[model samples]
Target: MVVLNWNGADDTIRCLHSLDAAALETPFRVLVVDNGSSDGSVGRIRREHPDAEILELPSNLGYGGGNNAGFRRAEEMGADEVLFLNNDTVVDSGFALPLLTVLRGEGGAGAVVPKIFYMANPSLIWYAGGEVSLRSGLVRHVGLRRHDGPRFSRPGTTGYATGCCVGLRVGVVRALGGFDEAFGMYAEDVDLSLRLRAMGLRIVFVPSSMVWHRVSGAFEGRLLRKLWLRTASTVRLLQKHGTPFSVPLFLLLLPLRLVPAAAGMFFSRLRREESV
Candidate 1:
C-alpha cells in the first residue's frame, strides 16, 4: 500500500493505523511517501508507525509525481501490485482482499477500485464507481452523495477507477509509464483509466471492498485554489483525451458552471462575514 502525505500527518497516521488493523490474508507493506511536507509529518509518521517505509521527496510533487515515486519504489521492492490510497481515508478490515481477488482473477484487468463513502456520513457514497464522457469532457463519480443501495452492490467493469483507493497491477501501470504527471493533481486518475481502457484492459469496481474518505480533506479551506486546479486539469484532460467536440463544449459550458458556483461561494462568504 502507498499513501501520499503532504503536511497531513494526523490524517496519514490515522489511515496507517486502519491499515495496520485490517485483516488480510495477503502480506502487504505500507510505504508512506512524504511529498516534501514541512509540517514535521515525516518525523511524526516515522515515530508513530516505525514499521512503515518512508520515502521523502525534496519538494511537493503533487499527487501524480508523489504516487509515481511510490510506484517505482514498489516495483523495486518486488511488489506485483500496489494500492494507491489517499491519506485521509479509513479502510474496512476486509477491503484489501476483495480488491486483490478482482485484480488477480481472470480477464485483463488493469485496476480495481473499492467502494468509497463519505467519512462524515458513512452511509452516503462518495464514489461507488466512475464514469468518463470523452465527447462532453465530463468525468464524474457514479454515485456521488447518494445513499448506498442494491444499485451499487453489483461488481462489474467501470469507465474509470478513482485514485482514492484503487489497486493497480504494477507491471501494467509501469508499462503505461504510470500516471501522466502533467496532471498535477486532478483528473490524473481519469487519464490513467482511459489509457488502461485503450490498452484493452478493464477497470473493475469491487463493491465488497470499502473505504471512507474525508472528502476534500486536503483542500478544506482553499476553495478557489481547488477550483482553479480542477478547471485547469479538466482542460488538460480534454485536450489530451477528448473528442473533437470536447474542448469546444467544455469551453462553452465552463462559464455557465463557474459563474453560478463562484457567485454562490462569494455570497456564502459575504453572509459568513456579515454574521461574524
Candidate 2:
C-alpha cells in the first residue's frame, strides 16, 4: 500500500490502523510518503508505526506527484500490484482479499476501484465505478452520494475509475507510465483509466471490496470550490485528448458536467440552511 500524507497524520494513522486490522492475513507492507508536512506527521508516524517505511519528500508536491513518487518506489521494490489509497480512508473489513481476487482473476482488467462510502456514514455511497461523459468531457462516479442497493452487484466498465482506494496491476501501471503528474491532483485517476481503456484494458468496480472515504478529504465546503478544481483538471484533460475526433463531442456534452456541481451546491446549502 502506498499512502500519501500531507499534514493528515491523525487520519493517516487511523487509516493504517484500519488496514492493519482488516488485513491480518493479507501480508502487506505500507509505504507512507510525507509530502513536506510541517505538522510533524513524519515524527508521529515514526513514533506510532515504526514498522512502516517512511519516505520524506523535501517539498509539498501535489497529489499526483506525491503518489507517483511512491508508486515508482513501490515498483522498484517489486510490488506486483499497488493499492493507491487516500490517507483519509479506512479499509472495510476483509476488503483486501476481495480486491486482490478480482484483480488477479478478471481477464483484461487493468485497474479496479472498490465500492466507496462516506467514512462517517458508511451507508451513503461515495462512488462506484462508472463512466466519464464523453460528450461533455466530465467524469461521473456511478452511484456517488446514493444509497447502495442491488444495483451495485452488476459489474461493468466505466469510462474511468476514481483514484481513491483503487488497485492497479503492475504491468498496466508500467505500460501506461504510471499517472500523469501534469494532473497535479484532480482528475489524474480519470486520465489514467481513460488511457488504460484506450489501450483496450478494463477498468472495473468490484462491489464486494469496500473502503470508507472522507469525501474530498482535505477540501470540504462549497461545491463550487470542488467543481472549479475539477473543471481545471477537465481543461487539462481536453488539452491532452480533445481534438478533431473529440472536440465536437466534448463541446456538445460539456454543459452536463455543471449540473452535478449545481445540484451539490443546492444540497450543501440546504444542509447548512444558509447561503454564504
Candidate 3:
C-alpha cells in the first residue's frame, strides 16, 4: 500500500494506524511517500510508525509525482500490485482482501476501487463507483452523498477508479507509464482511468471493500485554491481526452458551474468570520 503525505502528519499517522489494523490474509507492506512536507511530517511519521517504509522526496511533487514515486518504489520492492490510498482515510478491516481478489480474479481489470464513505458521517457514501463523460468533460461519482444500501453492494466493472483508495496492477500501470504528471493533482485519477480503459482494461468497483475518507482534507479552508486546481485540471483533461466540442462546451458552462460554488465559499467564509 502507498499513502502520499503532504505536510499532513496527523492524518497520515492515523492512516498508518488503520493500515496496521487492516485484516489482510496476504502479506503486504506500507510505503509512505512524504511529498517534501515542510511541517516536519517526515520526522513525525517516522517517529510514530517505525515499521512503515518512508520515501522522502526533496520537494512537494503534487499528487501524481508523489504517487509515481511510490509506484516506482513499490515496483523496486517487487510488489505485484499497489494500492494508492489517501492520507486522510481509514480503511475497513476487510478492505484489502476484496480489492486484491477482484484485481487478481478479473483478468481484464486494470484497477479496482473500494466503496468510500465520508469520515465525518460514515453512513453517507462518498464514492461507490465513478463515471467520466468525454462528451461533456464531466467526471461524476456514482452514489455520492447517498445512503449505503444493496444497490451499491454489487461488484461490477466501472468507468473509472478513484485515486482515493484504488488498487492497481503494478505491471499494467507501469507499462501505461503511470499517471500523467502534467495533471499535478486533480483529475489525474480520471486521466489514468481513461488510459486504462483505452487499453481494454476494466475499472472495477468492489463495494465489499470499504474506506472512510475525510473528504477534501488536503484542501480544507482553501476553497479558492482547490477550485482553481480542479478547474485547470478539468480543462487539461478535456484537452487530452475530450472531443473538440467538449472543451468548448466545458468552458461555456464554466460560469454556470463555477459561480454558485464560488458564491457558496464566499458566503461560508463570511459566516465564519462573523462567528469569530
Clashes of each: 0, 3, 0
lDDT of each: 0.88, 0.80, 0.88
Model 2 ranges off by over 4 Å: 221-223, 244-259, 262-276
Runs in model 3 deviating more than 4 A are 23-26, 259-276
| Model 2 lowest lDDT segment of ten | 267-276
TM-score of every model versus the real structure: 0.92, 0.89, 0.93
Give per-residue CA lDDT, model 1, range 117-201, as digits (tens).
8777779788988988888767778987689999998999999989898898888888889989988989999999899899999
The alpha-carbon deviation from the true structure for residue 13 of candidate 2, after best TM-score superposition, in angstroms, is 0.9
Cα displacement (angstroms), candidate 2, residue 61, comes to 1.6
Which digits, one per residue and each the tens of the lDDT, describe model 2 over residues 1-276?
899999999989999899888768677778998999999999998898988898899999888888888988898889999999999899876888877887898588888878888765678787877666644575677887788898976776666788888888888888888789888768898888889988998887888888888666576565668777777788778767765445556656657757866786556445334322
Candidate 1 has which clashing residue pairs, if any? none
- The C-alpha stretches of model 1 lying farther than 4 A from their native spots are 23-26, 256-276
Whichever of 2 and 3 has more lDDT, that candidate is: 3
What TM-score number comes out for model 1?
0.92
